[model samples]
Target: MREIVDFDNLKMYINGEWVTAQSEKTYSVINPSTGKVVANVPNGGRNETKQAIDAADQAFKSWSKLTAVERAKYLMRLYALMHQYKDQLAEIMSLEMGKPFTEAKGEVDFAASYFEWFAEEGRRIYGETIPSNSPNKRLMVIRQPVGVVAAITPWNFPLAMMTRKVGAALAAGCTAIVKPASQSPISAIAFGRLVELAGIPNGVISVITGSSGPISDEIFENPIVKKVTFTGSTEVGKLLVTKSAHQLKKLSLELGGHAPFIVFEDADLEAAATGAIASKYRNTGQTCVCANRIYVHQSVIEEFSEILVKKVKELKVGNSIDPTVQVGPLVNREGLLKVEEQVKDALDKGARILCGGKRVGGELTEGLFYEPTVLGDVTPTMLITYQETFGPVAPIIPFESEEEVIQQANGTEYGLASYFYTQNISRAVRVAEALEFGIMGINDSIPTVAQAPFGGIKESGQGREGGHQGLDDYLEYKFISLGI
Candidate 1:
């Protein structure tokens, strides 16, 4: 008999049972690296989503009643269990999401840290007694769990995004129904399995995956789902907000980004060049905060262009499972075409392609692989400048002054993350503050940790995830007064 992956029988997990959808439709999960059919997830629709919400509602009644210490114990157990399966989860994630094994492992580790952090945070949820103005009157303010939550996570950083929401939900003693992205449902389903093994009661955490339209509508319409946390594109985020507003549902959104990576003349050239590769090309440039636009100071523009373009060419693009591969294919056919359209439009609009601007073919063509492309002489009016190039293509532009670069960088409406490279502390601090992004990094390209909140500004997003900020989304506060 051939061996079968338990999750391959991918189905909805509701009230602790791994079951098929009532709709009986199925969606294929494609391995972006090779464009191979990896697995099939249930085509969950409104009926199945309602089932998940019902499970969560039932779970919340008891879950919310648990004492803080009791809830903390469950999170601690979940954390320890995640550590045990960390490597396995990483491998599954890499296969499903087409991220390199190394990066996928890091994501798994990062996801686990959220569980650990929130597990501790559960014990520290604070309440206060307040002095009342009226005589013999007492006032108290307490933070309570926001009831059943609907947590919808995106494909990128599949595990971490799920953990970011679920961790805070669990920590706050709220039951949740998770809708992991269709492209990467395996990890989320596996997480449900692990939660079961960790001794979590049935219905406390339900995992469901399906088409975006019906499933998402079901979640928003359900009265039992008190809170909804979402991570994805800005357009979708707005639609969700509109739907949730009807019932006054709680929301937390971490949406799209067109992050700017600024390279000043005072920056250490070598470090900036090195960091550019990691910032722009890691995971083949699918990151929400990956340096979409690189603004280089004119003084070092030529030198930076030469070094950066050379490094971009040297990166190996292939299967994510291969340890040698530094870049992988775009996530799907839609993603590949989207990036290709942007690249072609930019090229047609007088942008000079300095290196690699075409798609891979022959044996490589079987996959969604595109070369790491670099463009120069790009004007701000071009589509590539205004829209997000979430693929491996990056456009480099030169600026003459700090004020001009900052103005250009902040020109875009999206403001999730930005990067600066300068050795001078005063200039770095000044530039970092001036950039109109929620998150800024100086001399670094690494994404923020669990201790720091992550989100965007303006069109980028509203609300936050990770750190104590994540806990903020899962709670609601009320004040009460007593007179004797």
Candidate 2:
């Protein structure tokens, strides 16, 4: 059965009202599964973005003044709504982003976890009382909301990325303007409805979809937008850093990652191979923390490559809406082209393709579907090794020693996430620290959780998301003293 999404009557939410876009333009969202246009998302420009920010700014004065318990109630309500609509949101994500339905559901569920986590954090937001050295004097520190926030998210994991930012901001009592990726705006718009159903105040949360460049610039220029939170490529993240710096606006970014999965000798080979299948193939390898480069010790390279090749070959590449499919198409034509170019470059640079490396014949030729590819004999100098692939391609390279592999993994300009497979506890600890990344996995690929802080290091971008600390990004501290 083909799924249909209605976007014709879509409108931007400003001050709790769904209003028509100032610009009479729309973009067609194509289903990568069948190469069919599923929805017509409104192409909002700078004007709509401004309206959202202004509304949020006006709402923040009252919102930030509310008691933490009151704010927590709203988040709790939102969380309940998300749970009620998880299936629909997951289906929408699969249709829009080309992720396997099961994985999409997982992301939707994870997204809901944010609301729950931050909602609890709301009641627990604490201020410190510092003891003074002088007699008859008291000192204390307090934390307060940073005011209106501009949250820009990517298309890969629409729901999770949006909630990761907005959930914390709302829990901290900040109003927000969400500018979701233009490519996949359906789920985000659906999220807007959930906010309303949850009894959130007008302008406390607004959704703006379309061209983000001009809108982003406007929001950055607006003095009322006290913070900017984004999740995307490092190149764009750098620009936001500079723009935020101009006004010294508070910023949190979860940018690009080329996570390396290292397999050392004396490790559980079977477990490592299975882990790779899950980590590298999730969301068709579109995740920021997906394992792109596999660094195998020379002694185990041949065995690991053989097992990995067999697994890659077994991946069912087809429509994301199909429950049985394991891998889906890329997000769009541009992504397909980028992956094609990277694969071709690797082959040209003496790398060998072991399994699937080309597009498959399906109902959608124009749709972006790249085959799950496995490349061997990749050199450290190739772009695939140092740069993020961000597709359904996994390249494996051989390393002789732990020291050499660690150096190779850390060579990239990006240091978002890295993984290792070894039974030696001491070596795991040693290699974990040696690898200069924000997140690491020992015999695992999934490093993020609602209880643990997630972010990157170096050029992978700045700040953290998820966990109890996620709300800290939205708060500023003040110290006060009293003396007789």
Each candidate's lDDT (Cα)?
Answer: 0.86, 0.87
- As for candidate 2, its clashing pairs are none
Give the CA lDDT, 0 to 100, for residue 12 in model 1. Answer: 73
Write the residue-wise lDDT of candidate 1 on 1-484 in tens digits: 2111375577677888988888687888888877788888888888888887888888888998998788888887877777777777877877888888878878877888888888887888898999789889999999999899988998888888998889889989899989999889988888888878878888999988888888888888788888899999988888988999999999888888888888988888888988889989988899899998999988898999999999888998878887778888888888889999988888888888889998987767778888999999887878878888779998998899989989999998898999989888899878877888999889998868887889889888888888787788889998989888
Quote each prediction's TM-score.
Answer: 0.96, 0.97
Cα RMSD for predicted model 2: 1.9
**lDDT of candidate 1 at residue 128, scale 0 to 100:** 98
User: Considering every candidate listed, which one attains the maximal TM-score?
Assistant: 2
The runs of at least 3 residues in candidate 2 whose Cα sits more than 4 Å from the true structure, single-residue gaps closed, are 1-5
Task: Superpose all Cα atoms of candidate 1 onto the true structure and report the RMSD in Å to 1 decimal.
Answer: 1.9
Where does model 1 exceed 4 Å of error?
1-8
Worst 10 residues of 1 by lDDT: 1-10
* Candidate 2 per-residue lDDT over residues 40-92, each given as its tens digit: 87788788888898899889999999998888888888888777777788888
